[model samples]
Each structure stands twice: as C-alpha cells, then as structure tokens.
Target: MSTQRVFVARLSGCFVFDPAGDRLGKVRDVVVIFRKDDPPRVIGLVVEIPGRRHVFVSIGRVTSIATGQVITTGLINVRRFQQRGGEVRVMAELLGRKVYLNDGSGTAVIEDVAIERNRLGEWDVGQLFLRRPRTSASPFAKGPTTFASWSDVREQQNPGEAQSAEQLVATYSDLKPADLANTLLDLPEDRLIEVAEELPDDRLADALEEMPEEEQVHILEALGDERAADILDAMEPDDAADLLGQLPEERSEELLDLMEPEEAEDVRALLKYGPDTAGGLMTSEPIVLSADATVAEALALIRRHELHPALAAAVFVTLPPYETPTGRLLGTVHFQRMLRYPPHERLGAIIDDTLDPMPAAASAAEVARLLASYNLVSVPVVDQAHRLVGAVSIDDVLDYLLPDDWRSHDGEPPAASAHPTTATIPRRR
Candidate 1:
C-alpha cells in the first residue's frame, strides 16, 4: 500500500488512472475501520467503474494519491463493495457532519477528512478541512475554509461507534426544533436515521412535527418501529394521529401497539375521526382536572414545562373520573383566571362555562369559525354525550385551514413563530 498522505475530500471524486495512465473509475467512497485506541484505519476505496458498476479497489494497489488523480496498479477487484461492521465511509458519512473545535471558541462542518498511513502501514485521520457556517450578508458568498489537525478537533464519533447523534445535536441544541429540522433535512437517509436515533424522543418529535408531511413520514419510516413509536408518543396526539393516518394500516397499527397504552388510546381515538373533523385536529391530552380541584393544582398543571403552549392556554375542568371520553364537561379555566384567583380557591368557583365545546363531528370550517369568533386559543372537543374528549388548538385549526402545500413554499409566511428569528426560509432568492 502507498504511504502517501492525502485529504479524503480531495481523493473523493478523483479519477483513478492505471499504471499505463488509462482512466478507470472515479472514487466514490473511502472505507475505514474504526478502533477505540487508535484512529480509524482507511482500508480501501469504493470506485465507480465508468461503464459498469461500483467496485472495490484495495488501497494496496494505489501507487500515489495526487491532486485530482489516483494512480494504481492495473489489477482491480471486480466485486462490488459492501460495507460491513466497523467500516465507515468518509464522503457518505463524515463530510457533512458538524464538528466542534477543541478550543470551543468556534465550530466547523467537516468538508473532508485527510487520511495517511503510518510507518506501521496503518491508515489514520491526519487532518481535517472545515467549512465554517455562512454568516455573510450575501447568501451566495462562500464561507472561509480552515484546516486543523484531526487531533485539534473534538472526537469524530462514527455511527455504530459510540452513538454520536446526541453529541452532534447538542452542538445545535440552542436551535429551535424547526430550525434543527431544516438542517436534518439536508442529510442522506442512512445518516438521517443514525442522527435521529440519538436525538431525545421529545426533541425528535418536536422536529418531526415541523417538517413537511412527506419528510415526516420518510424520517419515521427510517426510524423503524420501536424508536418511531417512542417519538410518536412524545408528540402531540393530534400530530401523531396525522402522521399515523398517512401510513399504511399495518405499519400504523404496529407503531400504535408499541406506544404507551394511554397515549396510543388517545391517538386511536383521534384516528377514528376523519382528517377534516374537529376531533381529528384536537390533542387528546390537555390539562384536565376535577371541578373541585384547587387553583394551586391548576396552576401547577399549567406550569408543567412539557405542556404545549396552545394546550396550556387553559385548563379544562370536568365532572368525575377526569378521563377523556368519560368525564362530563364542566367548563374551562383560562390560565389568566388561575393567576387572578387565590391558590385556595376551588376551580369550580372560577370555571368559565359561557363558551360551549365543539362536537367531535364538527367540520374544520366550523371549528375555525368558532375559535375565531370566540377569540379562543383552544376549545374543547366533546362527543354526542357532551363528554369532554379533547381540545382543538389554534395551531391545529390553522393547519387544516391552510393550503395543503403551505409548508412547502418559501417565505410566504411562517406556520409557527415559536422562535421567529431561527425559522428557516425553504429557499434563497
């Protein structure tokens, strides 16, 4: 094997020439085997044969790696390359991942990794070429490129190595879920799955909710059954139901079976209603307390950090049992009402019964009008028996009222301004 040092990025896409200087194939992927105690070792190259298919070229045959070209022995393996356990691909896996500087003052995305062989003939990551994130006023202007020794950067954890999705996401943790979702969309399927697997279920759920329905389904399918189900359980029941409704019945049922029974039951109920109905747009989980519960209890429920803002706008008070579809609707206590009343005041005393709940079969148009006319952020959904079943949120109503491709368009308007400054425009003009 050649002992020449070369940046994996430069080698990628470079044409391979035989000893006689005849063009053979272009480098498609650089293969490496990762080890804990030493750097990942480069093993071979996956090259795309001109008129044929991809084939494996052993590093041992390479005579030299120079700018834009790889000179190798005429001998080549005709077999197609298949990645096995412990093998990592540089261009496919590492190039686009975000990496932090060891000093923590700056960060750069791995544009390419440099690989070189030691005296012992083992390949190692020798250096890294980084592309700093763009912050210029002109979108087309390129960002500065900087080089760093592989050792000067934070550890680059390969997939199936130590599960670095969390580390990768943690670097962007300051970003809102929607912003994070945009970045995740740029990744390839396999890389997307690896990163999604490491994200906390709640975070993944939030990000998935912000993505387009097609993209959402794509990620969920890539997530596999168990992990996908866990993320669904963490999402708002209405959003979870919407996604499930888009999937095939068998796959939906499999995911539902994997979810926590309580959460699954709520989503199942939503699924029973047509996508155009009020019930389908409502989240089954909301702050529901007994009519006799104290103001302090209502305050505590509203303060729970996990409650979605729309759901937390008000606390629904119900009679007996306090379970969806079982409890009789009493009234709702707006968050402001809880704040106005003394902690010892009974919730029943402050319940606002002036506003009536919408029937489960109410059309989306009707739901929208009701919320708008009442200037309500959320309204309860009730069945024929007048039992409280769920609450339709303003966001959910908007989702139904907007055009089907509303999320796909760029710069028309933002769906949710939860973090306005961080919202990404789908394209640059």
Candidate 2:
C-alpha cells in the first residue's frame, strides 16, 4: 500500500469493497485511539451496511484506501459498533471541536483531520485544519482558515463551550431529513445539541418531525424556549401538536405562547383531539383548492418542491374558504385524474366524491381501513359541520402503526454465517 496522506472528510461516503469487488457498505466514520505523546493511531472504519447497521472494519483488514473506494480483505465483524475508553470517532468527536493554536493566536475550530501511513505502515493523524472563530452576529461570515501539523495544536477546549457544527453538518448535507435524523441520533447528547443549534430552523423542524417524541422533547427543551417556539412554528401543525403533547402542560403552553398566533392556532386546534384520531394525525396544510380552481393551478401547487409526497398525490376540492376547516368538502382529485383532463378544465368537472370523507373523530383503525380499502395515499377529514379540516397521509398512519422502537432499529442483522465474523478487538483503556 502507498504511504500517501488521506483526508478524513474525503473518505466519508466512499464505497468499501471486498477482494471480489462486491460492495459491502459505505464509510461513515474512522475510529482512532489517542496516544500519550504521539498522534492518534487509526484503528478501524465505521461501515454502514444494508439495514442501516453500523459494523466495525479493522484497519488491518483494509488492503488499500484509494480514491472513492476502500478495499477490504472480506472479513468484517457483524456486531454493532460501540465506543470504548480512549477511543474516539474522528468525524463525530474531533471535527467542529474548539482548540487553541500553540502559537500566540487565541482560539480556532478543528475543520478536518488527515491520516497517513508511517514507516511501519500504520495510519496516524498527520495534519489538522483549523479556522478562526466566526462572529455569531454574522453567521454567514467566513473565518480565516489555516492548516498545521497535528502537534501544533495545544489542547481542545471543554466540550460545553460554544462549538461549531459547520463542518459536521456540511459533511452530511446530501442526506434526507429522516436519514439526517438517524445520523444525529448517533451523536452524544451535547454534540447533538450543538449540531441542532447550527441547523436552519426549517431543516431542524423537518428532522425533528422524523424523530421519536422523546428525542423531539429532549432536543427542543435543550434549545431555549424562544428557539423551540420558532422551530415548532416551522414544523407541520400535526407534528408540532404531537411533540407538544409530550411535554408538560406548563412548558408546552409557554412554548405555544411564544409561537406566531396563526401557527399556534392550528397546533392548538389539533391538540384538542386524541392523538389516535384522524384529526390528530392529519396535516392542516394539505393542498386545498376551490371548486373553480383550474387543473393548471392544481398542477402548479403539486409541483411545489416542499410539498410532502403523500400530500402531493392529490388535491382536496372544497367550497369558498380554501384553508383548513374549509367551507364545505366537495371532493378529491387525484394527480393522475388531473393529468388526463385539459389544463384549463375546472377541477369540479372531474371530482371524485364517491368516497365519503372521514369525520375528525374517526379512530385510527377506521382511517387505516379506509386507506387500505380505497387504496388511497391520503383521506380527507371533515368537522361536524361537514367542512374540510385536514388530510391524513399514509406516511403518518404508518408512523403511528409501527412499533415504538421501530426507529431505533430497522430489524435483526443478517445471520453471522452469511458473512464470516471476526472476534471483537479490545480497545486501549
């Protein structure tokens, strides 16, 4: 193998293949053990395989680390990866860390770390990328950045101090909100908060919606009340209500009070219903159109990038008041039906009112049956006055129906016999 230097940031998401060229997984992080007086020694690579299982791949088994790929000896330990004493994940724990330059310069943040093969062929931390602190007042401002030998940095600051997640967030920038939520779940609590604080309100809100209720509460509370309220305002009304329902009444009310009146009102209305009911699971912001709306307008609304897939599958037709709790439910027009008609045709001409809309008080079981029987992506919900209130998407229904711990683990790992497993390697204490 060549003794060339490889940056940790570039190694992320690279494909890991066995000798036969069979792809095993993608590189998620690098594990290293710190040394007393020398640089940290690379021990292994964290590989996320099928089923989202994260397993350990020893560096000794790695034949080569080249551009966009890592060749392994085809021996992998299937056990879930766990951190041991003195062991650290280079990307998760070292990146975004606050450290001081050995020189007179005050403070700097660790942007990336590089590892290189030594004379003995063992990979060790060789270089560090650092950036001067950017003012919080101007978040978009770029700070002066410099590179130094690993030994040039003095020491890392206390973990509790202000830390940046700029590099960490940028590393996984291409992940979907749900996948990002899974990645955040792997971080230590304090580190997770730091990353959450750095994400944009809309992005954080989407990820929070995918997380479990307990995690949602923990992260929201960690953020002060004002910020929590802002995040809630960005979330879907139904999801925000579900999370607030998990908090204590006093704390929930305080956060609700801080939110904008219009957003708060929608959440408050949803909170009035039991969580298992159709009203509780439904989003009040579904694509709603008036009777005279043209197919062109409906298509335009469906074309929105931000609309949820299930919600975009159809358009709800109603009377005058286009917003939720709309005047009167006319019917629903599936996306396919709209495409078959002329763009200028009125939606009412092809409305599908054969299926009755479910009442807000309808039970979850009833909603599920309706969706299954009708083979629908979403079903319209109405109030006592027969006015449209919201629409429950299939995704939300599955989220409620799945086991509580489903998010924690996808399923059991592949049988050990399928992949030759190696004994666990002890880490330095």
Candidate 3:
C-alpha cells in the first residue's frame, strides 16, 4: 500500500524485491498509456524474472520505488506483458529520445523520467531530466543536467532513423492542431513539408494556420497547385489571403486559379488592399443582417456558432438586399445592445448611428488607435463607396501593434546550455 516516486532511469536495472526481501528480478521498462486529452498513466512494470520470461507487475503490487530497489506487494503476475496500440514504454522508447523544449531551444536527449501518482492513484509522467549525450564517460567528467515539465517537451523525430513518411504521418496524425504545428516546426524543412502533404486537407489547414507566415508559404507552395488550393480553400478566407500575399505574385495567382472559383474570389478581393491597411487586416466574413431582422434572428445566427466570438462582436445592419459587398450601410448594433433588446424588436429600431466606420485604406496603426480609443472589440471597414467590406477584430489589430518578432520572443528566454550545473531534483538517497 506504500507509494514512492522515482525516475524511470533510476528504476531501470534496479533489483525488484518481494515482501519477504527476496529479490525477484531487475526492472526492465515502465508501461504507460498515451491519451490525447489526459496525461499518460503508468499501468505496470516489465520485470525480468530469474530463469523465466519477462513478466508484467501491476503498480498495485508495488510497495515502494527509490534508489536501486523496487519493493513489491509479494504478489506479481507471471504472464508476459504485451504493449497495446496506444501504450508507451518509457525506458525502452523515450529514455534516449531527443526532444525540443518550448523555449525554441535546440534538441536535448531525455535521460530520465519523473513519475508521480495523482490523487486518483494513477501514475503520470510529470517531469523529465535531460542532458547532452556524452560520447565518453570519465569519473571526473561533469556536465549540466536540465530539468523541465513534461508538457513543455515535445518529441522530435530522429532523421538518421529510416522512418517512412507514412509512419511519420501516422505518428503525428492524432495530435492537436497546435501541438502538431509545434512538432512540425522542429522538423527539417523538407521533412516538414513532406509530412504535411500526407495529412488530410482540413487537418493540414488547421496546422498551417498555427505556423509562422514564412513557414506557411513554404509548406503551401511545396504542396503544389491542387493540394495547395484545397488547403487554402479549407482555411479561413482572410488567413488564406494573407498567406498567398506572402508568395510571389505569379505563384499566388496560379494557386488562386486552381482554387474553387468562389473561395478564390473571396481571397482575391482581400488581396487588393495593402497589407498595412484595414481591408488587408479585416476578415471579409462577419455576422451581418438586414436592418429589419429581429433580435431572435440575430440570436439564431449567433447560435449557429460558425462565427468566432470576435467575428460576432457586433451585428451590422444594411439597407435593401444585404450582401458581402453590401447595399447602403445603415447604423451598427453593438453586441451589448442586442442582449438588452426584446426578441421581437428590429435591429434597426435600436441601432447606434453614432459609431462611425473606418475606411478600407486606413492604416493598421490608425485601426489600432480607433479600436483602443473606442474600447471596441470589432470595428467595421467600409470602402470609399461606403460599401461594407469587412471588419477588423481587436486581436488582429493588436498583432499589428506589437513588434514584428513578437511571435519568436513570446517573453520567454530561449533554452541555452548551463555549464557544470545540476538540477534541484533529489539525488539518490
């Protein structure tokens, strides 16, 4: 019934002892189940039995783990342990693997793993200790050990290993879009694009949106005309336009031609404006309604949930037949006012005429100032002809206001080597 924490490295090759202090065998590997939404949990230990085959010992039968010994509850299973599809063996698979820390540091080899049991009595990989793999060992040689939380580390595929693109695709397919994007950034450029090509168009689009602009262009262009067009069509029109704008004009036009006419037209319309202007920054898609539309109708549209919160911040009411490049622009209805109005009331009845729209040619700085000064979450952009072109969200405006390299800096120090340093984790005792 007793429990203790020990690093996987320390546990490996340690003698396993039964209740009566009789040595059984050495610990071979730690088994864990990998799940997308939850931390991996230790299920059992693989221990080599003397003169017999390797067997699985459930953690429930483990009394303690520390130093060079694992004390068990005396009852251990004799059958061999089979690794299931989702199972991972920390000692066998991960111990010597290279990983990238979130701080954009170069790769480090995982040396040991720290495991702890949660309140629910499930052991989870909580921390990792890393060190540069040494070519030779000496009694007097000293080096720094790096300590990091498990969540901050991501496994980087080894290039020297003969891993097929299909295998790599299968390995990364289950990761969340953002996580997959982060892992892809650690890959060499050729491999990055190669692996991306194998992914489903929708998944690839999601991952591409999370990558840096330069990387996005490189991947999309390498995907070729049809695949690139499919992914761009899958992405938000505004995002697709921004990426295409980064490519050479001839290339961009060629890719645009390959895209579905409707989708390509939307992006082409966005590309007309200068990158620093309001039209360039705003999404052409936003929640819009006729002046006579009811509050109930507006709520229904918002409930459909296709629009992001920033995109639905306010409802713009227009005259006559409403469309993307809409008819005569009427007053705007801020989101707060929508909540206060009766369900049956018309949007035009409660619209705010005092809020002026920004011109499409307005500079990014001008747009940021307007949003900040007005305390607005979104502001509409109108062309010289006063047609409703699009709306810019505050988040987009802030991206422009911040430094160009803000994405790279993120206010965190890049991981650099610490010479002759040791981590604060407890030493063997």
Candidate 4:
C-alpha cells in the first residue's frame, strides 16, 4: 500500500484504531530519531489513552495513516512512553526550533514538519514548513510562510540566540495540568523557563501544583517575585501553602505579602497546621454549600469544568458563611446520592452525617485510613469549634503518602549532560 505525505500538525489529534476496528486513543506526538547525514526517521507515536496516560506505538505497527485516523497492527506497548537521549518529540521539541535557510535569507521558525514513507518502508521527515520574520521596517506585519525540503535548512548556529516558546506552548495547550507538568519536566531548564514565561498565570499555576516540590521551587524562583506571587495567587490554597512551606520563612513571608489579601489569608491559615496533618493536606476551596441549597445547585457547581474530579465527588454542607472555616460543619452530600433525590430537594434532607469529620490535626495516616475505610473521595476537616476548616481529597493524600521522589521515577531517566549550561536560579535563603 502506498502512503501519502502527512503533516504532523494535522495528525496531532487524529484517533488511532487497532486492526479489529477498536478505538485506541488520540495521537499526542510523533517520535523520531535524528541522524547526522540522513533525514530524521519516524520511530513511534505517543498515544494518549484513557486516564491521560501516554503509551508508545511503534512505527512498524502503524499499518496506515489516513485522514482523521491511524490504523495500528493491534500490538502495542502499554508501558509509559519515555523519550530517550537521541529521540525527539516532533511537536513538543521541534515545532518552534530556529533554523537558518541555506539561501542566507536569515533565520526562520519551524512551524510544521512533513513525513513520508520511503522505498525501504520507513518514514522520514521530508519537508519543513517555516515562517521567516518580517523585515524590521514592517515589524507589525506577519511573516512569509513557505515550505522547504528538510535538507535546505540548518539549525541556528549561534548558541546564545534567544528561543521563543510561542509554538511550543501552543502544541501542549490542550493538555491537562498533570500531563502538562510531565511534559514540562522533560524540558531543559532554559526551555522550561521559556515555556513557563509564555504560559498564562493560571495554566502555569495548575501545572506547578502537579509538579514536585523541588521543581516547583525551581520554577517559582526562576520567575521574578511579582510573577511568582501571581502564580501563587492562582494555585490552590493548599498547594500554594505546601510549596511555600519548602522555602525559608522569610522568603515565604515575602511572597505571601505580595499575594492578594484574600488569597494570602487562605494560605496563611493552612500554613498554621503541621505539614503532615489533615489541615495541611486540605484545600481551603472545596465545594461548599449552605444547608438550604438545592440538589440541582449542588450538581451545577460540581459540573463546572474547573473543579477537580476528587473535589467534585461530594459537597460539604455548612450552616452559614459558606466559605472555608464555615459557620458550622453540618454534613456531607455525595454526588451519587444527590442524583437519586428530587432536583428541588434541599441538601440538608440528604446529608450523610454517619461519618464524622476529621480533625484539623489528624495525622496523614489517619486521613488516609478515613478515606480508605469510608471509600470517600474527600473528607472534611474541622477545628475545635466544629467549624469546617477545609477538606482533604484523595489526590492530596496520595501526594503525601507516596515517596517524596516518586515524581522522579516516572520511567524517564535523568540526563544532566544533555544541557551543560542550563540557567541557574538561586534557592531562597
């Protein structure tokens, strides 16, 4: 069967199907190995399966690459896809690369790459779609975009040339925070900082929350004080407090001072608890509702795209002052139970008060036990006055219970030599 040339950008979201016509997952990226004398050869594909897990599909297993679909030989490697030393992720690492045209027309940014099957039944990068910068006289005008054979261009020679992350950020724009964080971890420090600077405050904050404390501190410090504080203001109160706890008291205080008063207050409250306690693991912004709230209202609030799945599994009912440290801890309403009740029924009527709320000072093990024993996605934490202080989600418990360096063990090995002169930022004193 003859295969037509395909542009990687067009294949980014195309679905992959097995020979049996069973849908597998969407193509997240194409992996290729660059060679010194020959064009880069396509090696495999990164397919994002359910749960946002990325797996590898060898190029040889791909029977066909048609419009809107990719048919595989049904044999796949379920292990997580780990990028090796010489392997390059076309979309993630190559899309925004700077290259010089052979004609000496100055530098152009790579916008897309085209791959075609060779006579030997192998896929190779054959063409490059690039955009040259507009002339200085017309700086405001868009640049001219053109296609050139892969061999007609060479990588930018100057080692100090500034890299722009606009295309790199665009490539991973649709990724979830956790998946985006994983991708960011693979980037060199300089590239990571560039991408972080280009990302929106909220998007960066979400990804930061999913990263390890060390990476979080590195990125937070790399960003200046103002930008760092803005990102903190956008992160969940619990996650912000946890990251701040890793810094010196003085530095932590300085950042908190720069955050918005309301946001800082929540973080400050969480900081008062022991790092391994329930309060420390609880998010100050859980789904809270008044006792008089209707089931329909509860469902609507949880349905919001912004709410985390674990946090949305249940609603906490309070007497009044619906925010954290709410008037009084009333009871909880599981989403499953809410569905069985009439839409107009008050939350109070379906409250599940059987399981007692965990104390703010409860140990990490105690919180885990409560969640496991009760099979609860989240459990409320209360102070001595029996007021709702916050709630701990299963994800929070897992982050604490897992090994400190667990994030570093995700299949990808360390490559210190890959980036010899990475930009360094001093840790907080």
Candidate 5:
C-alpha cells in the first residue's frame, strides 16, 4: 500500500551495455559530482571492461535496467567511452554523493558497493539495488542499511560508478515521497539532516508526517531551532503542532517566537488539546470550495492546486464567498461523481447528503470506530461551528494503542537485540 522507495545501495553493481548487444562491462565504481562548492552527486559510474580501460556513464543514455544488467542505446561504443578520460574513478571515491539517475526521474544515495561473479569465472558487478525495505509491521520506525537498494528509486540508469567514503554524500532524486521518508529514517542522523535540508519544503513536511514521531524529533533536534523552524514553517498546521508537542515545553515557546504569527497561531490552536484526543490529531489544511459553483470549476481547482486526488476526492463544496474560508458549509461533492455530471451542472445539484462526519473533540477510539466502519485511512474533523478543523490518519491511532500489537499478529519471534526498546511508556509531554 505504501509507494515508498529504497536507497541506491541496492543497485550498486548492475551490468552495462550499448546498442548492438555489445557487452560493455559492469559498473566498477560510482562517483558523485556536485559543485566543488556544493555536495557531491553520485552521478558517474566507472565501468569495468574486458580490455584494460574504463569509462564513466552519466544518468543520460540509460534506456532500462533489469536486475543486475543496465541497458542503453547510443551511437558510441565502449571503446570510445574509455578514450574520453574517466579511468581513475574507482568505487572507493564516491561514498556520499547524490545520484540523479535517468535524467532526474528520481533520486537515491550510495550506501555500499556490492560485487559478484560473472559466467566467465571473473568478478563483475551484479545489481545496483536500493538499501532500505519497509513494512507496516516494523516498530514505530524502520530498520537500517547504509547502502540503499534500487527499488527505492523511482528511476535509475545502468551500472553507476562506485563511490568511496572519502568522495562525499551522494543524493538520488528518483524516489517518491514515501520512499524518501523511509530513506530519511534509514540514513544516519548526520546524513539524514543533509538530505532534509535539500528537500522541497512541502515534500519535507509530508515525509515528516509519514515518519514515526521519534525520527521526527531526531532530525529536527539535529537541525537545531533555527533550521528546524524553517522546515516547520512549511508543514501543515496540525503536523507542526504535533511535532512541537513532542519537544519539551520550554523549547516550544522559543520556537513559537521564531515562527511567523499566522503559522505560530495555527500550531497553538492544536497544541491546546491532549495528544490522544481527536482535536490534537486533526490537520488544518484542506482543499475546500464553494458548494454552489459548477462542478467544472470545482474540478478545475483540484487540478490547479495539484492536491492529492484521494484527499481532495470530495471537495468540501460550501456556499458563497468562494475566495474566502467561509462560515457556510452547504455540502460535499465527490470528484468522480461531479465529473460524471453535465458540464453545466451546479456542485450542489450533484452533492451527496448521506455522509456521517465526526467532531473534533472526540476521542481517538471513537474516531477509530468510524474509520474501521468506513475503511478510511483518514477522516475529517470538524469544530463546534461545523467548519472543518482538521483530519486524522490511521497511524496516529495505532501509535497510541497498538505499537506492539502488530508484532504479535505477525507471529514474529523475540526481537533481535540490535535495537533495544522499553516496555514502559515514557512521560515526555
């Protein structure tokens, strides 16, 4: 169900080739090439060949990759690639560069370089896979591997040059939001902070929301108050409140002063509620629209805003003052249901009236009951005024009630001791 990607460590040793099925060789090393003044990119892969020569392949010209093999089509041959001056880049030089594979389709980090044996009894690169793997069953956080796997990448090129630790941090841009979330959690704290600083603000917020609360603290704490405030400014109001609530109250006031008044006030509103209560768990952002507009206009808003179709599927179509967050709540319109109507149909004409909604002040247990009944990962929360206040996600409830229950259902044996955990809940807030 999660579209999360893995780290590039998994795709370290894929085979390589050009047109005509001419075997070029496998990736020997990967090198990241960021600006001398900036972080390194794991952008180049050093290829090993049958002859005494090697070449570095860029993200371009990468046609496709299957398992451990890289497929590319080009006018030039392997011989010309070597003569172009990329002989010295071995896997030892590119430890932490970013790799923007396949013309920047996605991103990934270099975790480790793996080597395997070829059919001729000679050692060759095998697969360039991403590092981290995720499952809903894992404890509140994910497990680890320094080198990422290829599956974590949304797109990738053939055998990329191997990297050595001394080279610099590698960045891969080919991952989806969820994938980036897992990778961030899996990365070492220092490395994760660097990636977090580079991520787009909205995306950084989404990834943080999907992340376990513990990791949210680790990354923010590492960034210190100044940097953390910059990222928090871009997060949804409720999410920002939730994150701020996890820190010591003394630190909260200092951070509040650092935020803009509007952003600060939105977070303060949610901070007033107990974390386990529905009010504490609602999100303050929504793609709301007037209920009287033509269905066409409402649909246009969704596309223009680039909102998640699932979250904005049913526009909370209200009445009047389309420009302002208003007081009237006329009704709701399912995006698909609206699309089926004639282009001239009004939103109110096509609205459904049978939906049951929850109040913001309800306990999570009550909200869960509704979610279970409706099979929803998220549910809207409205205030005493009937206006939408926030939304709650399934993970929030599970964290409070079933952190360890899932492991029992999974029939997992006693956990390995690499990561120790406490049974008694800590009183932090």
Candidate 6:
C-alpha cells in the first residue's frame, strides 16, 4: 500500500553510500518534497552523487535520506552505491517504496515527477500520482490510472481552490473532453450527471460521447428530455442514434419528440439501418450533389450545404433522374480535388470513374475489405438499378465489424458480427 511522488528539492549533500552504508561521494542537491501545508509529506528522495544524475528513491525505500549521511534500504541492497563524500550536496534517494496521499487517494505510486516554479512565485510538485488498484502490479506499481498532470495535483492540494462535486458543476465545462473524460471516470456516476447537467449542449455531447457506454447512458437518462434532445441533436446522427439505442424505448421516443424534426428524422433514419451494417450504420445526411451541375456549381452547392455528417470521402454523383431507377450513379470526387478544378469544368469531367463504393447491404466484412482497398471513407450504395441510394461511412463500417463493447472501449467499430436486433435496414422506395 506504499505510494510514490518525485523529489523536487534538494535533500542530501553530494555523498554516496554503498548498499552496506558505506560513504560514496559528497551529498549533492538532493530532490526534496514540496509541502505547501505546515507538515509537507516526504513522498520520495532523489539521491545525486557528483558523477551520477539524480535518481529518485521512494521515501518508503529509504531507511533515511537525512544529514550526517544518506541511508537507504535499497543502497544496502545494491552493491555499487558505496562511496566517500567529496563536496557536500543535497541528495534525496528515491528508490524502493514511498507513501502518498493524492486526491484523497491513499498509497499511490510515483510514475513520474516534475517541479514547476511559476513566474508568479508559485511552486508546485508534479507527480504522476498512482491509483490504488484491486490487483497490485509488481507488489505495488502505478499504471495508467495513476497518471496526473501537475495542474491536477495543484488543484488537489489547494483546499481553498478546490471545490466539491456540487460546487464544481460549472467548472466541468471548462475542461477539454479528454481531461473531462478522465475526471468523470474517477468521479461517481451521479456526480458526472450533475456536472453534465450544467455544461453546454456541445460540451455535454462531446463529453458524453467520450465517456464509457454505461456512463453515457446514465447521463442521457438523467438529462431532461429537452436537454438530452439538444445534446443529441448537436451530436452526429450516428452517435446520437447509438446512444438512443441504449435507452428505454419510451424514453428514447420522448427524447426524439423533443428534438428538431430534421435532426430527429436523421437519427430515425440511422436507427432504421442495422446497427452493424452500412445502411444501419451509415450517415444518412451526405452531400449528394446534382449530376447536371458544373464543378464550380457543385462546389458552390457544397459550400452552401457545409459539412454533412455522413458525406464520407467522395462527393457522390448521380446521373439524370437522380432519384429514379433510370438515374444511375456516376462516380465520386474528393472534395479537395473539387476545389482545384476550374469552375467551368463540367462535373462529369471531374468525376473519378475509379472511385470505389460498396453496397449498403454489404456485410461488415465486405465493407472492411472495400475500405482496406480504397481511400474513400464512405462507399455509395446503389439499388438494383445502380442508382445512388445512400452511403456507408468508414466509421460506420468500422463500427459494424467491431464488437460493441470493444468499439466503445477502443473508440472504434465493434468487432463482433451484427446484433440480432439490428436488422432494421431502410425499406426501398
């Protein structure tokens, strides 16, 4: 249950000690702990011999890093540490074990340490504070959960600056999604909902999307229908639909009713597509430009339409009778390439005949194969007549081929096959 932190200040004068308490070098600037409080806790000691760069030794590991001579349980354990003192130097030997109280967490490990001396006359101890795990690694070691930015450490130590979960609701909006996600992961689910309730819809949506699925669902369910609707509408339709799928039918219906008609319809359409298939997983709101327009005209149309959630890689081109069976899909063009063509160039001239698009009905395996072979993010779907129906976004295909649990964890598509209940493909007109 020993915790760890880095020594930022000098503790021992240049001196060396052999594993058997033998003098090595004069104790030099030894890294010491920074305790803002009356009684600063000694997390670890960094011992520096003249020829040696300071290496941290945990306070737990040190029998003592005090004056007269530096003593450590590890120095005795390792044979090379013995040496006589030359010039006196502060040395804090940080090795072996140390104890720490981080974020009210007991006995965290010291992963990494940094010292910050602010221009404003502020000094902070930066420690990659560890979290106590149910299963301790190497008897005790901090892993991913123990990571901490200096600012986080600062916030934790300054009781005056720190706020309770209730008081910090407004502050949740201040954090970036990555930071917020980490913070939320450490907080209770109920506290996260409260904080989420206070944030803007955009922040709420991003934060929710970044959270674990169970947490995301908890927030969605806790949110008022209107609040949830606003956040859902602000999210990509595919993401919105995925979150909705995790909800109770009645609640999902209520939130949908609260959403904008256009946004609701977009989500509804995505809901119709199988959660694991392109049609099920694809973004319905793609930038389907007219086949009759010139490249210039089309570009202008695209600029007017702006970014579409499901637009994938190419600007899909449909032949005459764009919606009819006779209206055949021509090809696609990268938006970047479209900007370079002369405005007068006909859309037909810019269309890349080689653009690869897969069928909406294709399996995740098939979609993955096509995606691997082509650079396009989304492949266009064509009916029996080969007319443009919809498109399969690369994200959707990835989602299809991946398992829901892993996809959520890895932020990629699920790896398992389609869900049994996800057969709700869109009906052909």
Arranged by TM-score, best first? 2, 4, 1, 3, 5, 6
lDDT of 6 by residue, 50-158 (tens): 2232334434444443335555443311111222223111211221123345455654433333433334323335454334444654755533445555334332233
Which run of 10 residues does model 2 get worst, by summed lDDT?
420-429
lDDT of 5 by residue, 1-429 (tens): 322221234444566766556665665444443233322333445554443234445534455544566665532223213312232232333344445544443555454444332343222222343334334575666433443333333323357543223222233355455545754554444555766766666667777866667678877777767777877888777778888888999998888888888788878888987887887876655556655578778777767654554456667655544322335555667677887898779877777656655677799899889878976666666667766665566755665676633322122323322312211122210
The parts of candidate 1 lying over 4 Å away from their true place are: 1-166, 409-429
Clashing pairs in 2: none
Q: Name the better of 1 and 2 by TM-score.
A: 2
Model 4 TM-score, 2 decimals: 0.80
Q: Tens digit of lDDT per residue, candidate 3, span 172-201?
A: 556667556755664555567767877889
Reference-based TM-score of each model: 0.62, 0.92, 0.59, 0.80, 0.56, 0.52
Shift of residue 218 alpha carbon in model 1, Å: 0.7
Sort by lDDT, best first: what order?
Answer: 2, 4, 1, 3, 5, 6
List RMSD in Å for every model shown. 16.1, 2.9, 17.5, 8.1, 16.9, 18.0
RMSD over all Cα atoms, model 6:
18.0
lDDT per residue, candidate 4, 73-145, as tens digits? 7665555667778988888778888898999878899889898998887899989999898766765786889
Clashing pairs in 1: none
Q: Worst 10-residue stretch by lDDT in candidate 4?
A: 420-429
Could you tell me the TM-score of candidate 3? 0.59
Better of 4 and 6 by TM-score: 4
What C-alpha lDDT values do all the predictions have?
Answer: 0.77, 0.87, 0.75, 0.87, 0.56, 0.54
Candidate 1, residues 1-429: lDDT per residue as tens digits? Answer: 556678775665689887777777778668878776566777788776633345667777677776589887756654445567677777657776677788875777777688887887656777787877677989687668898876667755567653334335544465577656754664456677787887889888999998788888988998778889899999988899999999999989999999999999989999999999998888888788987899998888888887778888998888876878857898999988888989999999998999989999999999999999988999999999889998899999988887776654232432333433223334211
